[model samples]
Target chain A: DVKVTQSSRYLVKRTGEKVFLECVQDMDHENMFWYRQDPGLGLRLIYFSYDVKMKEKGDIPEGYSVSREKKERFSLILESASTNQTSMYLCASLNRDTTEAFFGQGTRLTVV
Target chain B: AQRVTQPEKLLSVFKGAPVELKCNYSYSGSPELFWYVQYSRQRLQLLLRHISRESIKGFTADLNKGETSFHLKKPFAQEEDSAMYYCALSGSGYGQNFVFGPGTRLSVLP
Candidate 1:
């Protein structure tokens, strides 16, 4: 089965602290994405990487950045964590040839 | 730019009833659409994609190009079908990023 592994299931961060959310996919997919899920806002894309060393900003990339130094791994970074950034973070990978996309078990982040 | 929209946020129905989840998209090029489901405590997974034209778990979606809509339907809903459903769309590009709808949570009452 296809697997997208997230580095953490739950995390708590302090204000102004730099944070990293890591994801690794075993499917050798070419596209990786980071999104934040909220109750009413749904899943808003934060960033996406099309290939190693190539990244694009999604609609909601104001407070977040991403890194994809390798094909199988993608990382989301919060330069300075804030209370509003606390939410469920999800990572997903897409097969370049198909329409199917696989998602990781989300990481619930809490910033105090 | 591509966007997916799910109109209903919540839907509750008794077992054995028919169910329909609406989805619409706005994109300039040909759209690749998919329906993803997330069960409680489970990771979000693809339930079906419009390109395959196949049904899974008795659920099927028909893509309407003129309407720019892809709606998921199940003739007889089951208790196990209750889950969060998301509609996603991809534009015409290699490794295109998907735009997802806000999702609809289905509740099947026993």
Candidate 2:
């Protein structure tokens, strides 16, 4: 089965702290994405990487950055955590052959 | 710019009732539409794609170019079918990022 694994299921951080959320896929997909889910907001794309070492900003990329140093891993970074940043973060991997994306179990992050 | 909308945030139906989830999109060019589902405690997954034109787990979606809508339907709703459904739109433009709708939460009552 195809699997996209997120590093954490739940995380709590203090305000002004740096936060890192990691995602890894075993399918060797060429495209990886990071999104944050909020009530009535759905999933807003934060960043996506189409190839190793290449990154693109999505609609809601502010206050967030991404690192794709390797093919299997894509990491989302928050420069400074704030209460507004608390949300369920999802990671997905998509291959070139299909438009469908496989998602991870998501990480619920809380900033206080 | 491409956008997707799922107007209803919460929908409930008794078991064996017909189910329909509406989705609409706006894009300048031809777009590929998809339905994604997430069950309780399960990872999100693709339920169906417009290009395939196939029914998945008793759910089907049709793309209407004139209306710019891709709605998912099922003949019967089951308790197991309760999930969070998201409509997504992907275009060939430079944006490349897939845009997803706000999503609808379906609850099938016993």
Candidate 3:
């Protein structure tokens, strides 16, 4: 079975503070993705990395950046956290050309 | 641009009753469709894909290109089958980003 693990299951940060969300996958998948889940908005992609050091902006990449220094780890960074940024974040990984993706439990971030 | 739409926000049914979750898509070219499920307190998981044409957990979905719809159906609902279902689609070209629907929460009553 494939395992995708997020660094934190829940987090709280003050406004204007910087935040980091880490994800690691044991499957060594080539594709890693960061998404935010909101009510009635579904899962909107924030950023994705296809390979080490290679990153692409998804539909909702504003105020967010990604790092993929290694194949097994992907990190999402928020430049300045705000109350509106509070939401559940999910990480996923998939094999090259495979449509099936495995997701982590998700981190619910609260910005006050 | 590729997009997926799941109209219903919630659906309720009794055990042994048939259930269908409607999903529609808007894509210019051929696209891959998938149904994902997230049970209570569990991480989201893929239920099935249109390309495979196989039934999983007694649930099946058929992609109709003309109608641009991929609706999931099950002959009988089980108590354990209650979960949040999401419809997703991937475009035929370029980046491999997938568009997902808002999702439908299904509740199966005993």
Candidate 4:
């Protein structure tokens, strides 16, 4: 089965601390995305990478950065953790050949 | 600009009732539409796509280019069908930038 694995299912961080959310896909998809799922906002794109070392800012890219150093791994970085940043983060990978996107289990981050 | 809209935020239905989750999109070019579902405690997954023209879990969606809508429908809803549904649109370049709607929460009460 195709899988997109996230490094953490839950995380807690202190204010002003640096936070990293890792996502890895075994399917070797060229496009990977990071989205924040909120109550009413649904999924808001944070960042996305179509190729290694190439990234694009999504609708809500402020206070966040992304790294795609390798083909299988994509990391989302929070410059400074704040209460407002606490939300459910979802990782997804999609192959250019198809429109289907595989998603990770998601990581619920709490900034305290 | 590509945008998706799900008019209803919440819809409630009893068992064996018909259910329809509306989805509308605004895109200049030919848009690839999709319906994604998320069950309780489960990750979000694709429920159906417009291109496939197949039914899944008793749900199906039709892409209406004229109306600019792709709505999900099920004739008889089951209790297990309760979940969150999101409408998405993919532009050119093979879904490099996917836009999702606000999502509609379906509550199928037994």
Candidate 5:
């Protein structure tokens, strides 16, 4: 089975603090994505990386940045966290062809 | 722009009853539709895709381009069938980025 692991399952941070959420995939997939899921808003893409060091902004990328220094790891960074940034963050990885994406156990972030 | 829509926010049914989760899409070019399910305390997983045309756990979905819909259906609902169902669409563009709908939560009562 493909495994996608997230660094933290739950995190709480004070306002204006820097936060990082890490994700790693053992499948060596070329595509990785970061999304924030909200109750009524659904899963909105924050950022995605197609290759090492390559990134693209999704629908809601504000206040967030991503790093893909290596193929197996992708990191989401909040330069300065705010209360509104609290959410269930999910990471996913997919192979070259857009088959099925494997997701990690989401990290529930609480920005107080 | 490509988009997926699951109009219903919640759908409840009794065990052994028929169930259908509606999903609609809007895209000019060819579309690839998919259904993803997330059960309580479980990671999200793929339930079915239109291209496969195969039934999974007695659930099936047919992509109707004429109607621009891909509704998921099952003959008998079970307690295990309760989950959050999301409808997604992969763009016809090169990247194949997926756009997901606001999911529908299904509850199968006993």
Candidate 6:
């Protein structure tokens, strides 16, 4: 089975602190994505990477950035955490040839 | 730009009843659509995709290109089917990012 692993399941950070959410995929999928899941708004894409060092901003990329220096790992960075930034972050990886996406367990972040 | 829309925010039905979750899309090119289900405390997973043309867990979706819709339907809903359902669209391009709908929460009452 394809596996996507997230670094943390829950986190609490002080406001203005820089935060990083890490994700790794064992399937060597070329496409990786970061999304923030909210109750009513659903999952809004934050950023995505298709190749090593290549990234694209999604619908909601205001306070977040992403890095994909290696093929197996993708990281999401919050420039300065804020209360409104607290959300459930999900990481997903997909094979370029297929549209099926494999997802990680998700990280629930709280900016206090 | 591609977008997916799920009209109903919540759907309620009794066990063994028929259920339909509406999904529509707005995209210029051919769209690849999928239905994803997240059960209670479970990671979101793919329930079905349009290309497969197969039913999963007795649920099926048909791509209506003329209407730009892919509605998920299941006859005789089960209690286990209650979950959060999301419809997604994949654009045609390099690095095709997926656009997901707001999602519908299905409640199956026994």
Best by lDDT: 6
Q: What residue pairs clash in candidate 2, if any at all?
A: none
Candidate that beats the other on TM-score, 3 or 5, i.e. the better one:
5
lDDT of 6 by residue, B1-110 (tens): 88888989999999999999999999998889999999999999999999989999999999999999999999999999999999998887887888899999999999
RMSD of 1: 1.0
For every prediction, compared with the true complex, DockQ reads 0.78, 0.68, 0.68, 0.70, 0.65, 0.81
lDDT of 2 by residue, B1-110 (tens): 88999999999999999999999999998999999998888888899999999999999999999999999999999999999999998876443678899999999999
Select the stronger candidate by TM-score from 1 and 5: 1
Distance from true location, Cα of B39 in model 4, Å = 0.4
Using lDDT as the measure, name the better of candidate 1 and candidate 3: 1
> What lDDT is obtained when candidate 3 is compared to the true structure?
0.92
Whole-model lDDT, model 5: 0.90
For A22-105, candidate 6 gives per-residue lDDT tens digits of 999999888999999999788899999999999999999999999999999999999999999999999999876768998999
lDDT by candidate, in order shown: 0.93, 0.93, 0.92, 0.93, 0.90, 0.94
Q: Give model 4's docking category.
A: medium
- Per-residue lDDT tens digits of candidate 5, residues A1-112? 7499999999999999999999999998988899899987778889988889989888899999999999999999999999999999999987656468889999999999
Candidate 6 residue spans exceeding 4 A from truth: none
* Model 5 C-alpha lDDT per residue in residues B80-101, reported as the tens digit of each score: 9999999988765445676789
Candidate 3 residues A1-112, lDDT tens each?
A: 6499999999999999999999999997888899999988888889988889989888899999999999999999999998999999999987656778899999999999
Instruction: Judge candidate 3 at residue A50 and give its lDDT.
Output: 80
Who wins the DockQ comparison?
6
lDDT tens digits, residues B11-105, model 3? 99999999999999999878899999999999999999999999999999999999999999999999999999999987654457777898999
TM-score of chain A of each: 0.97, 0.97, 0.96, 0.97, 0.96, 0.97
Best by TM-score: 6
Report per-prediction Cα RMSD to one decimal. Answer: 1.0, 1.3, 1.3, 1.1, 1.3, 0.8
Candidate 5, residue B29: lDDT: 92
